[model samples]
Target: MRYFALATDYDGTLAADGRVTKDTLTALKQLRASGRKLILVTGRELDDLLQVFEQIDLFDYVVAENGALLYCPASRQEKLLGEPAPTEFIKALRDRQVNPLSVGRVIVATWHPQETAVLETIRDLGLELQVIFNKGAVMVLPSGINKAAGLAAALDEMKLSPHNVVGVGDAENDHAFLSVCECSVAVANALPMLKERVDFVTDSSRGDGVIELIDKLIASDLSELDEQLQRHNILLGTKKDNSEVNIQPSGSSILLAGTSGGGKSTLATAVLERIAEQKYQFCIIDPEGDYENFEGAVVLGDAERSPRLTEVLDLLEKPYENVVVNLLGIAVEDRPAFFAELLPALLELRSRTGRPHWIVVDEAHHLMPASWNPASLTLPQQLEGMMLITVHPDRVAAAGLSLINTIVTVGNSPQENIKAFCEALGDCPPQIAPQTLETGEALAWFRGKQTEPFCFRIAPGHRERRRHARKYAEGELGEDKSFYFQGSQGKLNLRAQNLILFIQIAEGVDDETWLYHLQRGDYSRWFRQAIKDESLAEEAEEIEQNNRTSAHESRDAIKGAIAQHYTLPA
Candidate 1:
């Protein structure tokens, strides 16, 4: 179900000589029966398409006029995707005697030779328009309006993502829309340039090529071709052989297990950032509210209130949004029951839209504990893909744990975590050497696939998180890590245990004492090595280098940097 829709070009791709064959029609019908929607993208006008093709009802949506208009067959409603052909531009074309001109709701078209005249007329008129070449046909439309725009509009209306679509076409004009689809196919008769760029080229030309694509799509959802489409893979890291490793867009149920304070969140953040980069939506089920203010995501609930399921569903309907479902407001005893209700709803949404592509369950054991009956939870035998992050995989329900064929261990003892997981599932654990993983390192074992677990360096997150930022902001740091205001001549023994205390002390310390610490680079050093916040340290270093500023100004600048990064007390 990775591809929930097929968008195909008309004329050269779906029909030959402006007509669809009986066999092609049959294929379309068969494909529609598979619960997949069909979109017809064409350069032809809506009126011409309706007159020539009596089987228009077979399509869910028709993008006509080279992306300037949308037609729904069931409702027989026509929506203008772009403005109508400019009257001044049309008059200028006629004045130039560009013969054989045909005008639609938004597109004005003519044969190849007329394009020279059309271009001149647009130039003279100072009109903002673009010329698209479809075989010999030249069409003019508003800039930025094309088959891709029309198709995107249709998908938006349908609540579908372009990532769940397979598009097929021929000729140069087909390039725009096809490029936006998850998988692009060029028919054998397609232009050579187009064939070179597409994911696959059908052996059969014309309508037969479309039928070939359809058969393959229905047969396996094109799973056999997955390996060839590596552009969509989520890069995790490289293995010992220095070969790149990735999580397939679908079919990978990963369990990221580690102990508390073991750099699990760091790895998880990196993976989440990559997922968002690929335009795949993800929903994080965060029980502890750790993801507040995470980049590229919308936090749904906070400590004071539980997020409503309806709100989550409504926000996800937009397709581009990532959500964090924080459960801290919900009582711990009620969290599992809340998740039991939420997972099914999310699965149902994914069934239709093929997104939010990844569902990240944080503290997975708490939500699907071993003590709970998975039958009552209505856990499915398979999900396209999801990520489960927890400290104890064995504590999670058996059904949930069984789905984790790919295990990634990130902690002091990788072998112990893997053994606990395998023993819980009643399977022999793979022989992994006892090794303590370093920061940004993890042991990965694909059960029944790899002979042994392999260690790989984890990719860094795009945004630098102030790790344990809450702790560093409010809780006590070790005496060594804590900042001390022992300024010049060691006159003051003031200790600033946290960021809150550090800022307050910086504001009140003697001017000479503050200047001493600023000149010594102690503030930047502690921020980098102790708080482990690189961005903050960079800002502090910049302020420290410019010593002309008064101590009050430097203190304010340093305080501002910290406040911008971390939430502090009022």
Candidate 2:
């Protein structure tokens, strides 16, 4: 789910006059019953919070002492996340007669007028501490500690991502954690600046406001918050005018269209990398087994076994995890039927939890061909968080194309592809000329936007894109396509026939044979021309030029580079 956990401030948010209302308590129970977690993030001391609120056990975890202490209600365990206030510091404060001093495990606090004394004490002692203000209260904490850090710790322990959390607060200290959450909410009586900064402000004040938010979450899973997802928009690229091009994560479908070897997968890989970085959950339906090795995603199934629908759904139930459903073992003709069965369950899950935020279908034409009956599949009228990658747009179902609001074409005839996509839907194509684009560049057109199509360079992916390992190992290499190695006596036509055979030969060859290939840049040339992987080829070239070591070491380096790019058969 986009937001499966709610982190909330205690005072001025879930409580009024140091007490939670019965209504709010019931709402909390209902929210927990819905399988959502509740975390209390407050500046209050753990002991103080316990004295005021008897229902402390209702929350799963509590961050107390303004982010210095973490409390688990079920275990009744208090873990200090920050160092305690120094005894000398406390003595100095007391010696200066700083009245109304309150000290906790890791925090020292006082009212507003005493902040001057606190600051003086800090400076005089040369202490590495900071004071945070919340209305009349001033809290002293260790440097680098805040509600955000505490929430992060709690999420880490719980196996949750900050992007799946919705935070609500009403005070100055609330800003840090709220900013990190996927959606920030503020109560009606929140500080003016805090309210202005949040994505949504509740109509009711105090505990009532929290209850209102909980009700909304349960009713629609906060579907009304689709617009708020814009805050975490992914940058597509920059426009010709130097403006940034971006796309929101909700209620939007993206089509990455181009012919084979035109960088369509590369562009999609870049986008998926950004998605993973943002911690949004995505399920990749990999028809060609291309994305199995992408970072931060769990690869399900392989060539010998097709992923079961039940298993896929179970893995996706966790909001923090990404899944790549490899369709290598599934028959080509059976895919559409499988997807038809899977899509309805996915839609139902999203309806309940707003999870699996994106469903990426690589090679869209194969699964939803134009010849298939759209009515046979249970597709949504308004596709949200869908990305379709394809070489032939016209081959995909017209119904599928109708839901795409953004088209990113990455080939020489981008405008022509856009026109074909439009014609497939029986709509007039936007007037735009096709521009020649280099690799990792595209022409993006947002369906309803007034601006014309613009050329943009795709952002490089953080993780290496997965190459087609089986293809490199088993696929044919024509005589003209083979890479040859030269020797002392004569030219050895050791054809770079397949990755598996090439690796075996390289490993068994003598040092002289290995050095001969390395010195001649044969490995780099073969990687570029035979393997069709420019990035790996570039790395191989760098290794060849930089290695001043033994031939065996150079062979190991080259083999490592190839293994990184292609998976060798056992």
Candidate 3:
């Protein structure tokens, strides 16, 4: 169920001449029976809409008064989404002879040709309200109030996301709400502008068009239009010829394969950042706590504790929260079993909510080994969007590899990785020139492209993502990447393998020794190259160059800089 709800405009959309057809009603019922929700978004006032339409209860929610009011059909509850129409404003409109005027709890509406008078009265009164036009109807409501606002309020109350909604509309006023839905439809009778802008315009007009839409949703979830919604496709990178490479957020499976220190996490970070920016939820099955400090997501477990399955699921149910399931506390061999149990629950949740939109399985080989079979359910069919990253694709389960539709290889062995993946799938691999990918570059093969894989510059992330923050902060770094202090005469030979050790050693080293390294720009260089923290390095560079500051002052300043970004030991 990609689209979990249908939000339809009332006038000239779901209803023709303010009446819904029996066939449309039957279609709506059948859609609801499919376990999807329905919402009515209309510019008509609640009282008028209720009196004119007998099938009010057909919708779970009614976003009326053009987004100024929210009503729950089941509870018979009405909530004002915006402040009520001001008494003075209404009185002024009456005085101005804005004829055929009507007022709702929060809307003041009149037929146009009086819109000039409405605008003049608003200016004369110096009111902070906006006028919206729906064909011949002129409506006045608070600024930012519209069908979209109302629908958002209704969706919030329903615990649903706009990405899970499919909206249909007919006229100018429908643009706001329709634009926000994952899929927008316009009836055949819809205005030319609306029809041009919508994802699809129905062949049939009015309520019949709605039935056509509902039938399509129930039958296929509108899968035929998957490629048509290019607005939702995430940009992966640009190709060799400078053409874009995009991954559709829905029904996509990507394999990001590379060796350690190959910048796979860096590439993955950029993708996740894009997902978060779009407000889609993702669950990262972090086998190594690499994402514990990831931005815009709640880190479920840490180095010392593994979060319970129920806790992770409970947080994910919100449809807005992202979760990082850190497996640091879970033993290495037991990770596959934990993920085996977790995958089904996650798939079940997505089946119902269409969320945790992307599931990222890091270190795929270790977590879902080739020996671990998921035969009970077909992963390639059940899973929608996922990114599986591993050093060895052959080590990952064949079932898991089957889910991949696009293969993005990072690091030195790009061709080998793709060839190995193709062998694992028992398919012929595409040919490519034998070469090494430069730093921050990747070779991507999108299935069915009819061409060999091409190299592209990997897009960078905004944040200096401390990918594997725990490793840089606490774990041992190889001697090559570690910072060593044997300053001046080499009286004291101390190696700071990680950040915590660096800070402790800095505090104990003599002032002259500290000054020696600080003067040499060693701190900034080590931070940028070893820790992979560019911002922290810039800050350290600033502090290191200031000769007026004492060694102790620089130490505190540097320590504070690290603490500002990375969490330091208390």
Decide which is better by lDDT, 2 or 3.
3
Q: For candidate 1, lDDT tens digit of each residue in 1-570? A: 899999999988999999999999999999999999999999999999989999999999999998999899999898998888779898888888998999999999999799999999888989899999988999999999999999998998788999999999998898999999989999999999999999999999989999999999999999987878877898778877888778787778899999988878888888898989988999999999989878889999888999999999989988899999999999999999999999999988988788889999999999989898853357787765789999998898888888887888897898899999999889988777788988778888887684578889887676634446778898899999999898789978999889999988888889999999899999999999999889999999999999688888998899999999998879
Candidate closer to the true structure by TM-score (higher is better), 1 or 2: 1
What is the TM-score of each predicted model, taking all chains together? 0.81, 0.67, 0.81
Local accuracy of candidate 3 as per-residue lDDT tens digits, 1-570: 799999999989988888888999999999999999999999999999989898889899999999999999889999998898789989998888779999999999999799999999889989899999999999999999999999999988988889999999999999999999999999999999999999999999999999999999999999999999998888877867888878899988899999788779888999999999988899999988889888899998877998799999999989789999999989888888899889888888888888879999999999888888663353635467889999999988888888788899999979999999999889999887788988888988986667678888877776633445767888899999999999999887799999999999999999999999999999999999998889999999999989898998999999999888877668
Compute the lDDT of residue 502 as modeled in candidate 2.
Answer: 77
Candidate 3 residue runs with Cα over 4 Å from true position: 374-380, 464-570
Deviation (Å) of 191 in candidate 3? 1.2
RMSD of 3: 7.5
Cα lDDT computed for each candidate against the true fold? 0.90, 0.85, 0.90
lDDT of 2 by residue, 54-172 (tens): 99898889999888899999999988999998999999999999989999999999997999999999999999999999999999999999999899878867767677788999999
Judge candidate 2 at residue 205 and give its lDDT: 99
Q: Relative to the unseen true structure, what is the C-alpha lDDT of residue 58 in candidate 2, on a scale of 0 to 100? A: 84
Model 1 clash pairs are none
